[model samples]
Target: MKYIAPPRDAVDPQVFSRMPLAAWRDHAGLIEGRDWPSIEALNAHLPAAARECFVAQTRELLADGLHYERRIAERGEIATRERNWHDLFNALVWLRHPALKRALNARQAAEVARMGPKTRSRAQCALTHFDEAGVIVVASDPALIAPWDAHDWHRLFWRERTAWQDGRAQLEVFGHALLEHALTPGKLLVGKALVFHSTQAMEVVLAHAAAAIAHGELLCDPLELRPLPLSGLPGWHPHSDDEAFHRHAACYQPRRTGRSYPPAVRLGHLGRAALV
Candidate 1:
């Protein structure tokens, strides 16, 4: 991959590593009991005790079932209720991490049940925010916390050119839902996006991810990399109102949350997306 800083000039370089979705979905051990025949075959997931648990919980959360493709294909909106992805390259997340997916649904369901569904309580909002978090960034050194919490986007992406190539960084963006719920949630979460990777990168690893997400979109894109609002993601106005861009981008600092972030998803455990 080539890292080019537009308008000329490079910044401080760093290195980060990543595991693509294919590495997760196609892993022999992981996929052994987790593979599904097709998107329509979600109901026929491999037989396992955990499968029953995930399916039961999934039914409760998504009354209509995880007809992810149908919903997304017909209307192009992922049902926030219960259905998630895998038919497409990015869609394979559900097929890849069933355990994590089950855990997240349980968490999301519990939060909604306790908060009465309509209440946007701080805790409820926090749960959903983390539940639907955008990125999971892991750095070699914990010291990078200070820069991350500071919302250092430009430096991370453009300046730190070698960040991901060398192994100092590894990003897991596609499995946000599973990662958020599988691990603990707390404090303000921030990431150095320059070394970031999107869920769509699974296409490169699997050689069969749908074309929808084949092209790589930079995380440090000044316009698209805005701090996500606490309420929800870009273009998702569930309750109402019109906030076009991320207007509520707040910079995280040591005073508010701890220095080291990205604790929700265990880097060591989940970073096996490497196809090599």
Candidate 2:
């Protein structure tokens, strides 16, 4: 199939937040299980600025998912839950391309044959199951298959496309092995960390966390993470270490026996407590 380039300079951060969740989900489904147009083909269809936007967005999304997974794994309570989350996100990433989805059917046998005696016997043994069930087959429409003409599509389209590409590259570089290992029980032991402690924090925090995790650093302590509250949301406090304070506020489960519970510790407070 031919590749079409999305419009140039079409990214809008607000679109991601304001677009209806259902629309995003539907668009995701449409693109999932498809292969991306080759870089050369994309260049033909889109302007340089648009192409750059696509690349930037792709990198952002991939980095976001990777960091999120790492943080979740660090918590130590829910391996299965984390695995499921990882699987779903990974599948979503895979599904971003129709070609990849279709190719998954024959890629396994082909991969094994290509590897031959040089193949890791363990890897061959593992892929047997994925070759059978996990690869999904979905019908494709001609419009979906056509190249992106960069007409009047929404800005979010470019953003989503960029994010998907970046996420896929990350999977190829760092997460490919992780995908194989995570597929089976005991295949691997992946750690998780809770990266976002509060939704109330600035959007820049996500960018910062993504950067740190991409470079293999700890973004924050998992136990202390929480979502920052949106303005006008109940219990929103303007002057707190929002992430830490909200985490403490939300996680305040009463003890079965009534003794005074310690005050919620802010992220900044952790150092003082350590020194004490």
Candidate 3:
């Protein structure tokens, strides 16, 4: 029912990492008590000056609940509005998937309910901030997922591009922030993923991450930017291992350790590893 701006330093660096939504991290501080209302009721709650920011183009965004794909197609462009970063992001998240935000909040609230507000146990902390740190991609078939746990992101994401190209795999980034909150914790949320296939190949994720440590920037050039799909993501594969991933051959190769964190501290009933 209430949200608070976690301190910038306190904000988990790993949270929102590499994800397009990561752009919203800095704006979190601006919207204290982050309880956002439904899109149908959101505008009435905004300040008069802030209300004017929506403009004619985003009337649908402000007035109704539409999935991101539908709203973007209807608006016929990237449906973005810059209302101080927080509101813009709030609107975007709601626009993209209203269910996700609601589900994430409900799940977090349930965790708080179970663990008690003041006590952030390791599991409690992980579950509470699951949206930012945890990511999982669910595909249609078990065969399509084999490469993930085998640490074969190259095949699962890149070499296997044909799977996505043909639209056979049917990947969906789970609205688990809703799925988990509902506690139907299934096989989909079992493990972690390298990156969603739909994500753009932005070097800044690696650039920023690369800048933080020695030799990390060498992992990927800041200049090369485009959606390389699976190969574009950093740390998904052991690019540094030349026998496996040769740098001269890659269009966008990022060399980094191939290690992924679990989607949850404890998956509860969903014990299997997801993307691995």
Best by lDDT: 3
Each prediction's number of clashing residue pairs: 16, 33, 5
**1-276: candidate 2 lDDT, tens digit per residue:** 222222222322233232111223443332223343332332343334321211212443455433322222332111121212233333333333322322332333344455653454443333333322221111122231122122211221232234223322111111222232232221111211122222223223323333333332322222222111121112212322233432344322322333222222222323322211
Model 1 residue 108 distance off true place after TM-score fit, in angstroms: 2.2
Q: Alpha-carbon error at 4 in model 3, in Å? A: 19
lDDT, candidate 3, residue 215?
20
C-alpha lDDT of candidate 1 relative to the true structure: 0.33
**lDDT tens digits by residue: candidate 1, 22-122:** 23534323222323233334434434543331222244545655343233333333333222222222234445544334433444454455665456445
- Regions more than 4 Å wrong, model 2: 1-23, 26-88, 93-203, 215-221, 227-252, 255-276
Give the Cα lDDT of each candidate.
Answer: 0.33, 0.27, 0.35
RMSD of each: 16.3, 21.2, 17.5
Residue-wise lDDT of candidate 3 within 1-276, one digit each (tens)? Answer: 423334333443343432332334443333323343333344443455431223333776556654333333344233444323334444544443433444434444444566665665454343333333233343334465455444454665556655654544432232223221211111112222323232222232222221221222111221211122332233322342233542233433343466332221111222222211
Candidate 3 stretches with Cα past 4 Å from truth are 1-87, 126-129, 133-136, 172-276
